[model samples]
Target: MITEQIAKDIWELHSRLFDHRPILQGHIRAFVKEFEEKRGTREEDRLNKIKTQLNDMTDKYIPETETALDTFLTNIQAKVKVAVEVCKKIEEKENNIEVGFLDLQRQRRREEWDVFMQEQFEKSAKVDQDMDIEMKKVSAEYEELEKKIEHISTATP
Candidate 1:
């Protein structure tokens, strides 16, 4: 009995082979190459010979173990399924690592900007403090000068 999974796998391979014609010229050539390999040497005699052999085998042996081929193909597909899942996991992890790298870069930039802004703010604050101290000294000197002029004017008068 042919299972549904076998049918689905066959459909997938058929679709890849027939329904989805590849876009690249190289891929088309590769397909032709593979077909020629399978069809035997681009010669009619070779193809006919292969056909006769296949027919002979089918007539002699295929009836006796029909399910064996299907089971073997299905088992190979099961192994392929595991490999595909592992490859998907590896791809996902690689994507996550790329995202993490970008995020880390952004974080470092943010921290650098914060440090630069903090340094600018500190410099501004220091300048303000120095201005305030200078203003106080100037005010005190101006007051003392005013009092001296007033005393000198009183004495002279």
Candidate 2:
């Protein structure tokens, strides 16, 4: 459950980063395009005005883009840390549950040494196998998530 929540949070952060990236890119592209188009125009005064407007837009948006990128990175870092912690907690919980099951099996065997040993052993073995499988799956998922987060962190827009 915690892993799922972490995944969701990470995905939401990824979505927000992508959403902001296109807006920033569009603004920058527009400023460049207008500046380029006005460069060869015969109207000096109009060209100067357009250049000034483009500069102003660049000045405004560059800082905003930097800040947004910083915020996005910080958010992703925090979420990844949280996800790692959640995975650790889940591993701990699984260990505790396994131990508890072992104790229950011992108690069951003690209560009826001959009657239920085979059934209990088989049940316990099956559960242990299932838990092992689940742990492997969770580990693989966590690894994949970590890789994705790393890619997101290092990727250039």
Candidate 2 lDDT over 23-75, as tens digits, reads: 88999999999988877575877879999999987999888999999989999
Model 1, residue 142: what's the lDDT? 96
Prediction 1 TM-score vs. true = 0.40
Residue pairs with colliding backbones in model 1 are none
Off by over 4 Å in 2: 1-115
The best candidate in terms of TM-score: 1
Q: Give the per-residue lDDT of model 1 (tens digit) for 1-157.
A: 4688899999998987887455576798999999988677558787789999999889978875777877798999999999999999999999999899999999999999999999999999999999999999999999999999999999995
- TM per candidate: 0.40, 0.28
Candidate 1 residues lying further than 4 Å off, grouped into runs, are 1-95
